[model samples]
Target: MTADTPAPEGVRLQKALANAGVASRRVVEQYIVEGRIRVNGTTVTELGTRIDPENDLIDVDGTAVQLDVSKRYVMLNKPTGVVSTMRDENGRPDLRRFTKDWDERLYNVGRLDAETSGLLILTNDGDLAHVLAHPSFGVTKVYIARVSGTVTAQTIATLTRGIELEDGPIAADKARLLDASRGESLVELTLHSGRNRIVRRMMAAVGHPVTELVRRQFGPLHLGTLPAGKARELTKIERGALLTLARQDSQASPGPEEHSMQENE
Candidate 1:
């Protein structure tokens, strides 16, 4: 085995928890402080304790802890007006709304605004989440926006060139007007920056200004045919592609739900 791969036997409780990709060191410490861990039928409360995972009996919250080989990934077609959070004191936009019947405990990889809608991915893989949502991961976001005022050829250039805002300069890696009316246009924007309300703020910084913003893609995953308020498991290919994307540097790409129209669109 490579030196980086720890031997399967004689690993410690904290190390096992971390190795199983369960919790961080600080969080596992809290479990220890709460006396929530057990070894060979005895409560383990010491923070410095160690035990072998392969041979020793380990339990957390009275449930045996086993290393997991499979990971769970979920893609939700988030509708506008629902908050994108695990929980809130105001009792709104809790993830339970969409995951009511799912067996897995899923958490959003990142977040979308309550006023925005489109692809929102959830997963039980903390390491994958770190790779997707972490800014340093540089995961790309693809958005479709409806904006006021005509998007002149020059305006599209400003988007490509970058615009300065109170939060600092923001620009799309690439963008184009997909549909246009007299004074409004649907624009597809792709970028590696996942800043808050970035699509809206970016358009406002320029002259067009967004009236409605919807996410169509995040990395290699798409909202696909999933209806709003409903969810589905990631296809084998979807799961494989995400791991593939994580291995490479970032790039602009589309996944799904380019706009928040009825499914017919």
Candidate 2:
């Protein structure tokens, strides 16, 4: 019960970190000695320090490390014409068809309209999902859009400057014209907004309606050569990148209680 006494429960800090894939046990021990690891906000340099992996927050070099081994992160290349929901009330093509292999109930972090197709993350980790899905976290998404008109440099400038929509004003973090020919344009846009049908709307507002839209990247995850309608577990590096992104955002923002108090005032 003394402040100096070690807790009686939980696994050793280095062991937990190693099991979480932070590094090998020996490397984690070195990290501890270097004061690069922290448990529950306190720097933990002792190799024997115990921590409740389920409850304690662990961070390495200021980025959080997810310790829950049961957590699952999956990436899916959703094809066009399939609804984002696992179950659709309208009897339309749904995501369930692509998720049968996962025993754990995984839900999408965000959505792409039925008409659009691209990278989608389905995960059983609620904490990671919340951090990635929430617009306040400012996770950037990349989209490749084919629009029905010639896209000039001026239009790309306008997208980054700002655009007024029905809900409010929005702006792309980055925009570039990939190709413009034969009365059609291929435009790549980077945005942090999670608004519904935002890419399509932005294209229309710019006088070039989107003929086809596909998400190319979400946060640190990219839709590489993964074929459409296929799903796969996130690689070790991919998972680490995602956790780091979530941790960085969560640390930069105020906690819920503090944000709520500010809102009330």
Candidate 3:
């Protein structure tokens, strides 16, 4: 937490890029391979190499990189029908469209699918995004889903007990048939898997096709009453917690030549 403290161990370069808000890990890796990333005034192309994020020097496109310390962290009450993606060449409204009123260049932290609604995080801080999105942290997401058919207690048990999806075996930390009758049930699931359409796939595998889905919570973050289509910056405490979480995880899984960055809101 202080300069005197040693740099985080096992900090992956891509992880630092994500934490910097420059781009996703995949995209950043491509940039690295293309010779766009430099560590301490040297071009870096090796993906396997790691560096200390907090203590190392990372340069992208001739610009020095550091943690996005002042980047704006926001909570958006995403409305249904609005996609959470950054860009869609198909001409659909993406998350960036919602930020036209704000000056900061931002990216969605994790995601809420096009059909899903509720708490969506948008931020310029790349490390926060990286730490939050990384599956290694075992981030728990809570979703409230409405299904077409009544979900029996056995179905809930199956979800909680774990089921096999097309990807592989998956399990929700908890589940309940809040309203098993009338073909309307509130199903809650928590898992670390971040595969696309994971929750929907898991439910469909259990004979409970989702009719409507909304993300209610993500880890220590909440949706509260921000209202549909509204965004609010994270509090100082929230931002600090995010950084602390990243530091903790980085320490736990410290890489050899991790990357880092800085941002202005």
Candidate 4:
């Protein structure tokens, strides 16, 4: 094909978008005419546009779209005592109890200790999974912990300022005391570290032991009113937000190879 020729090797844009559940084929055609769709960062108004859905970056109204229909993303409000592993050798409560209904073999992104419960993502999309679970991406997570004793302003300050642990020094991105009583305190903390039991460890390091902990948010996903032990597929908007986060992170921080190429250039 010549430089000016359009490659006739892929499916029509409208059909591909429709099959990906973006919308009906007819609506996708209208979107094309309205210039609301973009492929590979270029707006395409032609209805005859064909795209390789697997390789092309497609966006609708600036929100990244996941065109692979085979990928499944599930949000589970993991209840305390349930292990994050799909299968546990100890035969205790595990994620398989909740995910067995889905046909795709899904695995948890990152993990939550058996004692700590909150938003857990189960997905089969390896690329997105790696982007989220990898510490290099720095996806933030929010947790609310009820700890022993009253949490003073100094304690909150120390958490954000930094603290030393056995593994290494760690700090919360944000910290605040939600409620304080005579013998207990409710504190909210935000951190991007994926350290094992970091919240519990941090609180203990600061002289307050965490009595109970619940993760309320993970990156763009929230556990809003999701009752414990319930699992549901992510909504379209949630998936878009998640994909946008991953895309933005991947773009902002180039891989080692990309950095090397840039240096050479």
Candidate 5:
């Protein structure tokens, strides 16, 4: 509880910048340490320094930092072969392609692998992003995966029990067979952990290699027939619901597995 204390008059400078859509809190903290941030015309290189957003004049690289109270929350039904990042080094398709016309600076809340596709949230509100992405918050994501082999009830039990990967142990919050009776079958899984390629790894570990995977839901948001590669702004109610979930989850005590997932992610 004593880890961080907000200033009586205002919040941390990095938080202010993050809320204003400058960047993530971690990135804003780096900007603070790198001397790129100035408050009231005075350079500040100390982390956790507080500033009055209403009164203090803040700037980044000499440009006046205007507080953007209007933050954006976007939902993208990402398509396969598109990278989750805003920019890619190899010139591959990225989120910027989908969000190019957006005026607000946005970053992905979590990530979907280039081979995986589905509901992806992009937001300029860094605080909300942190909570959703951070494993400790326990915001569940649901995925429907088509695997190469039939998945049985025993496999579902094993998946729910948990599997040990190189990174850490991952357990599904819930699992069910969506379809079966052929060489390929569909399985639905819900989990809170966000380790890289976790669902693929877990399914492959159970002798069912995933052929296709799509995240159908993230916390309270659902893909709901959203076309692949299309982007849409989150409704105010949807945004509020997600924020409430994140806030409630963050206040709970994190398990050891959650800590491991955080480190690995």
Candidate 6:
């Protein structure tokens, strides 16, 4: 088909591959050109190729591709010292150990550092994952931190005003001193920034090193009382709410201060 031609009936081949969790649409197109994908026992190399997923005999690298229509969404109370990855190359504790009971391939939405722990979502729904992970959606995450220094009001102010990090300037949507001790304190932080090790680095930058960190909430999902290393499928109501949030039209420009990132309970 010509470049200007509209796609034929049924879904595009790459979209089918991505929805089946094989890979992203762009990567799947490459696989088609490389003759790694076959539809009804015939190699499909055209970018405009379309197939009825229900009727097509699709295969990838000689393996039959059975689309998993039953998308699974799981919430895991991640424990400290456990990596948020499907596999750990060093043979260290990873998400696989906790998700051993699940038969479907699941991956964490984002990540929490090995030293940090709390609510984490694992799912095979690539569209939902992409929506939630993308910064444009502005999904807020709340973290509670135990710091080694007296978390003064000035520290909280600094965090709110924005601090220059090694990567760039980042500010928390909200920062509050949960509790304070003689030399240490508990601070609750809320932000939509998904920068690497941001909470730890931000606290350290403000001279209050994070001794312990736990993500209290992600978007509408909360850790609640789920024990560490335990997994549970999202309830029907919870799942519906999450999808609604993901589908909402994001603002034209979602600056850190513009969106409301409230604490969950």
Best by TM-score: 4
Best by lDDT: 4
Q: After superposition, how far is residue 177 of candidate 1 from its true place, in Å?
A: 0.6
What clash pairs does model 1 have?
none
Model 1 score (lDDT): 0.73
Error of 3 at 189 (Å): 1.2
Whole-model Cα lDDT of every candidate shown, in order: 0.73, 0.85, 0.72, 0.87, 0.81, 0.80
Candidate 5 residue-pair clash tally: 0
Error of 6 at 24 (Å): 36
Ranking by TM-score: 4, 2, 5, 6, 3, 1
The predicted structure with the larger lDDT, 4 or 6, is: 4
Regions of model 2 farther than 4 Å from truth: 1-7, 61-63, 254-265
The lDDT, on a scale of 0 to 1, for candidate 4 is: 0.87
lDDT (Cα) of model 2: 0.85
* CA deviation > 4 Å runs, candidate 5: 1-69, 257-265
| lDDT digits (tens) for residues 62-88 of candidate 5 | 555555457688999999999888999
Worst 10 residues of 3 by lDDT: 256-265
For model 3, the stretches where C-alpha displacement exceeds 4 angstroms are 1-69, 254-265
For model 6, state the Cα shift of residue 219 in Å: 0.6
- For residue 43, model 3's alpha carbon misses the true position, in angstroms, by 36
lDDT of 1 by residue, 1-265 (tens): 9999986555567877877655787888789889998777688888778786545656666554544435677888888778777787797766678887667788887788887888988888776676687655567778889999878778888898989877577678999989889889999999777566778878877767778877888888777667877778776467657755653433334333222211111
lDDT of 6 by residue, 170-219 (tens): 89999999899889999999988767788888999989888899998988
Q: Kindly report which residue pairs in candidate 2 clash with one another.
A: none
Task: Compose the digit string of candidate 4's lDDT tens values, residues 1-265.
Answer: 7999985799999999998889999999999999999998899999999999889989999998999888899999999899888889999899998887799999889888888888999999888888888766788889999999989999999999999888678889999999998899999999887677888989999999999999899999999999999999999999999998888877787332211110000
Model 3 global lDDT (CA atoms, 0 to 1): 0.72
* Model 3: how far residue 36 lies from native, Å: 41
